[model samples]
Target: MFCPKCGATIPDSDNKEKSGSKVVKNILLVLLILVLMAVSGLGTAAYMMFHNKSSGATYEGKGYNTPEEAAKAYAEAFANKDINEMLSCCAIESYVDNLDYEAQIERYGAYMPTIFGGPIMTGDDEATRQINIEERKGQLTNFIIRAYLRVSQPIDSPIFSGLALQVGDGKEYDADEVVDMLKGASDIDSIKVGDVEDCYYFLQASSNDNSDKIHKTLKKVYGGKIEWLGVELEIDGEDYVMFVDAIQYDEKWYILAPHGTGASIAGLDVYSGGICELALLD
Candidate 1:
């Protein structure tokens, strides 16, 4: 050993060169790790950006697989004959109409064959590649859907147009049609229940036939509570608020709401009668 106390080149057998080399390798490894961390962060950001762009939408209530999923859920409710289940899937505004879910269950129970067996999907405008189901759901709650999809086009609720067209089509109008329509229009407990003012002039083309009969039918159902409000439908065993979307023409009035629902009626043609299903609150 030469000059052991001085800083000088050591013998080849010493570990100094290897120690320096190891420190260099550690520095390189640290730098490599930092680079990898940066790359990982960038990749995460890119994934989030793409995912948000492709599959994200802001929703206030209820988790959903898609808008289509909600639509299908509504259909499933009907298919299972669980009226409350179907209503539970609906947006708040519909229930807010004062026709609470319980009323819907009682009034619509007799018509399960029509509601559940009905199609949840259909083509519009000759298969124009439209988002019709979403548009329909955006238009009406399943409780108010009707086969008179044609009538549902011009008017807001299929219940009204469904009945009008049914009567106009001469589908053997009976007491049930009148009862169903009147029931759908019955949620007057709250002011906004009947929204015909929000939708206008489509039924001007309806036959206006049996307007008096329609009015009387309403009175029969509500037990004439309107007094000056013309005919009414009886709540009878129902626990629902009632209101009407009435139209005056040829000196007669028509009722739509608690009396009208997506519930279907027999002996009616929904199309060509210028009626529509109730509007949906998506």
Candidate 2:
């Protein structure tokens, strides 16, 4: 008999059992391939989803077309105590990209021998060293970001109220309370965007030598793709300005962290401080 699907002649009754087994094997093989393809598709989709989320491409507040818009959104998020929104407006991926473990090691390698009495060893081999560096970088980034978020809240909101942060003066205060005091005594009156050009110039002029080097490095790396904007928050009639470093990635703007105080906390060598005072208003 002829097989209808393949138009091939089927084995006769003499070989019927063998022919049946062959057909079953083929069917099983096709099913296995289908299953593998489905799994691969799902895996690819999942990876893409994760990448988009991490890169802020899928973030709701990531669609800001300009630096001013992003800064305004961040200020509004801060006022509303919206953590997710505030994070969305940040250029987290940019900060991550700028973290160069290899460069850091190279720059600090000379000092390591003096401190350790020998060459500081990261791992047994090159591959292992790379893996170890990446792991450390991830840990450092997480620590800095978490610390920043912990303090980046309204002082009166009760969020992170239990966490005590010591300011430049060596006085310990509740994270929330410190932020509230910095924001001012009353509710938010208005959020204003300062001139981008003027903000950039001010940042460059006011930055210390190390900070100036970082700014220049970032400018050299990003060229015309990055911007500096000042976000002025008028609370209780007092105008407090926060300078933000906005980076353009995939045609979207995101606020770069470790700009003011964040950078100081993370160490200026690890992350570059922007041209703003205290990195952020808070």
Candidate 3:
């Protein structure tokens, strides 16, 4: 047999001599101690490694070691409609503060469909709608239950989950309704959420398409070089472009938004057009 975690072979007890068995048992005990210690150390190391010093609970890891890797992971998470995983790929501090789990979930529920796809409309099927409602209820219930179980863990609480959930006239978003907006689109590139500098660089790099005009305009306000990308689509028979704002952190890429995230990052608004407006990708 092989050890599940490390894939190392484990000898059967029956094959060992009496003395060998004692040695093996001792070795196993030592290995177990080492494994426990490693696990304890790894948890801390992982937290420190992935955590953003300025923000709270933000983590970007698990093979998302490069800009391209993170971008792919982001796209995959979107494709999977995994909200937590998707948010992990991007810088979400602008909207999501620490221990603001409800807001995190709500924002995720709202923006995900818009950025990735649209709401799933159950077409006049009573049973389907009921099932969807039940599924959402189950998810929320599970979250509550898990949160309750981990009540002792201070970090687990999103600054008191029950209070957060109960506050305000919280609009209940049916979780099942969220769908991927980017399903039909091709894979995303390793673009980053750079500052005004990215805009400057984008304009500088391009010889045509109003480069000089755009460059001067950027310089007049905030100047920096960063990558800017546009995803094109047609909505309601009209051409619409989704501008992607990305940033590089620790050499990995993250999209600010599939569209501009309602605010600027690094003193640069990736897209100034209306949320539904069209911008030709020149």
lDDT of all predictions: 0.34, 0.49, 0.38
lDDT, residue 159, candidate 2? 37
Q: What does the lDDT come to for candidate 2? A: 0.49
Ranking by TM-score: 2, 3, 1
Q: Would you give me the overall lDDT of model 3?
A: 0.38
Evaluation by lDDT, superior candidate among 1 and 2: 2
Number of backbone collisions per candidate? 50, 6, 15
Per-candidate TM equals 0.20, 0.42, 0.28
Residue-wise C-alpha lDDT for candidate 3, range 99-175, written one tens digit per residue: 13333335445434223212133343544433433443333233323312221222223332333332334544333
Q: Over the stretch 40-99, how does candidate 1's per-residue lDDT look in tens digits? A: 999987755432423332111242343334434433443343444544444322212222
Better of 2 and 3 by lDDT: 2
Q: For each candidate in turn, give its C-alpha RMSD to the true structure in angstroms.
A: 20.6, 12.4, 20.0
TM-score of 2: 0.42
After superposition, the stretches of candidate 2 with alpha carbons farther than 4 Å from their true spots are 1-63, 94-99, 104-197, 200-216, 219-224, 261-282
